[model samples]
Target: MVGIIGYGVYIPRYRIKTVDIADVWGDDGEAVAQGLGVFEKSLPGPDEDVATISAEAARNAVKYAKIDPKEIGAVYIGSESHPYAVKPTGTIVAEAIGCSENMTCADFEFACKAGTAAVQTCMGLVTSKMVKYGLAIGADTAQGRPGDALEYSAAAGGAAYVIGEEDPVATIEATSSVTTDTPDFWRREGEDFPSHGARFTGEPAYFRHVEQGATNLFKKMGTSVDDYDYFVFHMPNGKFPVAMGKVLGVPKEKLEDSLVVRHIGNTYSGSSMVGLARVLDIAKPGSRIFMVSYGSGAGSDAFSIRVEDEIQSHRGEVPTVDDYIARKTYVSYSVYAKYRRTIKA
Candidate 1:
């Protein structure tokens, strides 16, 4: 009976247009729009970091779950870009959320899919009666080399979900995980930005894992793609998921409602988790959701979710994606550089 009890999301107040990058780099504007499907990306402010953003999202999750923070029994932070190499960001978030001192806390990192991994792990803890409630968070401050195509779309945001046993808001119907021993994308120690085989990133990294993961979940669940009302993927940029969704035979009608890879760029670990939060907000009871998460060390996790009747009454109030995006303050490229810590004093 372990399932998600609540969910919340946070996107920074600053936004950088993809066109701003195109103008400075003298690149094609259409490529930025058509190829990527992202017009703007959320940018974290000077005072924020992975821990701070995770804390904010955790607080909101507490509100949504209608649970006292002291009752939380575990906290997990999932990120590829943790602020400290060794310290657990989950501890900082737990303190901010006011979770008990006895709570379990740790961090998980497996590229973009780490967030889903955190959710799976928390489910195990709650199902085993080890925890009354737990929180899983995905957050990142991704970096891209200046002038690189990735710069325009790799940005920051976070999402949080509370997992518990009874009175679940959404039930996890089934899940499947697939792995491949390949390097579709990677960044070594001391490297500020990741490197990728662009074409391989599509076929081998993103498409292959998502396809296999979803297929396995559908097979195991005795359901097909047509059974789900919506599909959400870990979108690094907009084009990859759109193209893959088309090839995978997901109904075009189902995809029109997706929010990933659109309003916000990829949040690395936060990508699919935030999409899941958005889906929870709009999905009707009895609707099935298919979620596919991919990480570049090359793995994917797929989960089938059924919205529960309980969600309609308890879905807590939080800022909508439209509201958050509308609140964004546009900044100059120079200011973007300064905020990103790319400017040399």
Candidate 2:
């Protein structure tokens, strides 16, 4: 079966509390934190960017897969915050991870769901025998205008997966997607930060798309929420996914393990991917995982994944998601502004 041979995640160590950001903007930190359900958010260091974050995650995946990088036939780096507008971020990642020159490479942008799109692409390539193995990464140094609500949630992180037909850690049973031309969020060509439709981002965009995508997948696979052992949904903030779980009839326990957003904020393209990694960290063999990722453009991609027995042998080959979460140094709003380059000279 074609599926994930290995996976890895990277979260920047620098974090800023939601309360600290609220204090800078003269808002009540407790109220804002309660409203968003996010206590803190991550930020990149002065040298970290999407490319570096992606490369690091990919290297970890390669290490976990225990395969020669030269065997990877395709590389896709998906992000809204790609370092170069003109060059493909995938090439840099491929080279950094020691991939051979003969592989195909490209960059994908679908806002927060771009990474899942990459994973789907790799799945197609491997299933078609067009590639022996493929690498897909979702990473972002997400942007937020100072004092905007997004400043509290826009964050940096990434995850990578190695996909192939070999003995995999998990096998993808099905995947589905739903898309529409709803402008819930956007950034113009020269705009420094994104703009959203406020309340419009909820019902008509994220919720509708995610619901439809997941429903379509359920219909295709003939499975219900109770069939899955774990659940992961895109987390723009801590609240949306929890609310979505209720709407989808998923048990709270099924989603609790994947709630990394409560501490790290939204990593844009990396959001649901990192959450999935967190679930994989503890899922047992034969566990079924239901995942749906929403992108604000807007759309959602749903996946049905079943854990394989191979996971037991590979556990702890690389640092777990909790390892990164625990290895943090808190920063103030001013320091966060400097690292994010939100403050101009």
Candidate 3:
């Protein structure tokens, strides 16, 4: 079956509380936390970058898959905060995971959904027999302006999926996407931080795309939301996923396991996929999962996956997402600014 053979996630150890960012902006941290349903955001060390995060996650996937890295025929990394403007972060990740020169590699950027887009591409390669395995990674050291609303949620993390025709932990039943030219968020050349359309990023972009993507996938699969045992939606904030879940008729119990955004903030490209990873960690064999992701270009990708007995097989090779989430070291706003390089002096 063409699906996810293995998956791994990496979250940085540092964190900044919503109160910390609100303290800097003279806004009410409690109200901000209550509004967004996010308490803290994971932060990268000064030494970390997207490439490093991608490599670490891919290594864990290789371990989980128990496959030789050289057997992986392609590598795709999706992120908006790629370290080099022109260099492909995928190449760095491939080499780090011990992939050969013969493997194809590229980077993807469509905001948060780029990661899942990579997943779909990998599925195609494996299904076509062009590759024994393909690695798709959604990683980002996401950026938020000094005082913007995003500062409380934009965070650093990533996940890697090894897609192949065998040893799948979850097999894909169907996938679909919906897109439009919605400019809810953008950062022009050389801008250190991205700009957004405020409330514009919500109704017209995130909500619309995710709803349409999920609805179309359900129709294509000839099933309704009630058929899936679990659901994960792109979480730019904690509330959005929950809101969209209710809109799609999925109950809170189906969404509770996927709601890590409340703790780790939004990992951008890694957002929904990471949420799916959390669900897979605890899901029972034969469980069905529905996932949808949103990006600000904007667009959404939806997928139906069936959990296999294989998920219980390799998930213990590395620390779980919850393991990483529990191992945090909080930093003050000043230290966060320094590590994120918002201040030079």
Candidate 4:
């Protein structure tokens, strides 16, 4: 079966609370936090960036997979916050994880869903027998203009998955996607931060694409919401996915464990993939997981996955998602500004 052989996630150690951010701007921290359903967001250290985060996550995946990196024939890193405009982050990741020189490598950017796009690419390659394994990653050091609405949720982190046909931790049963030419969000060529259409990002962009993607996947798989044991969606904030759950009739318990955004904020490309990792961290064999990722531009990729018995043996080898969430140090807004480079000398 072409599925996830192993998965790993990396969240930055630093965090900045919503209240701290709001305090600087003279907004009501309690009101802002409650509205967005976000308490705090992650912050990349001055020495950290997309490349570093991707490499760390990739190494963890390699450890979890217990496979020779030389066997991985493809590597793809997806993010909007790649440190370079002209270079590929995939090469750095492949080399960092000790992959063979004979593999193909590239980067992807489709906003938050780019990582799932890379995962789909790996699925295709593995299913075709073109490669024994493929490494897919989603990571970002997301940018938000100081005091903008996005500053409260735009955060940094990453996740990596190793896809192969062997003893997989989770088997992918089906996948589908939906796309539209919606102008809900964008960052211009020279712009440091993205611009959004505010509420337009909700109805026409994220919700429309994600709902359609899930609907299409259900149709393709001949299943419904109740068939899955868990559900995960791209969490631009804690509120969007919960609201989506209500719209889709998913029970609160089924979607609760994946709401990492409540603490880490939005990890952009890493959003849904990291949520999936959290679900997989706790899921038992035979548990079914339904996941959908949304990207502004815009599009969504949905997948139906079933946990395998192999997960029990491999999941404990590395730190769980909760471990990363618990290992954090809060940063002041001024320190955060400096780390994020929001303040000029």
Residue 122 in model 2: lDDT: 99
Between candidates 2 and 3, name the one with more favorable lDDT. Answer: 2
C-alpha lDDT of all candidate models, in order: 0.85, 0.94, 0.93, 0.95
What TM-score would you give candidate 2 relative to the actual structure? 0.99
Task: Give a tens-digit lDDT track for model 3, residues 240-317.
Answer: 988998788898999999999999999999999889999988999899999998989899999999999888878679
Model 2 misplaced stretches (Cα beyond 4 Å): none
Q: Which residue runs does candidate 3 get wrong by more than 4 Å? A: none
Quote the lDDT for 251 in model 2: 89
For each candidate, what TM-score against the reference?
Answer: 0.97, 0.99, 0.99, 0.99
CA lDDT for candidate 4: 0.95
- Ten contiguous residues with the weakest lDDT in model 2: 336-345
* lDDT comparing candidate 2 with the true structure: 0.94
Give the TM-score (vs. native) of candidate 1.
0.97
Q: How many clashes in each structure? A: 0, 0, 0, 0
Ranking by lDDT: 4, 2, 3, 1
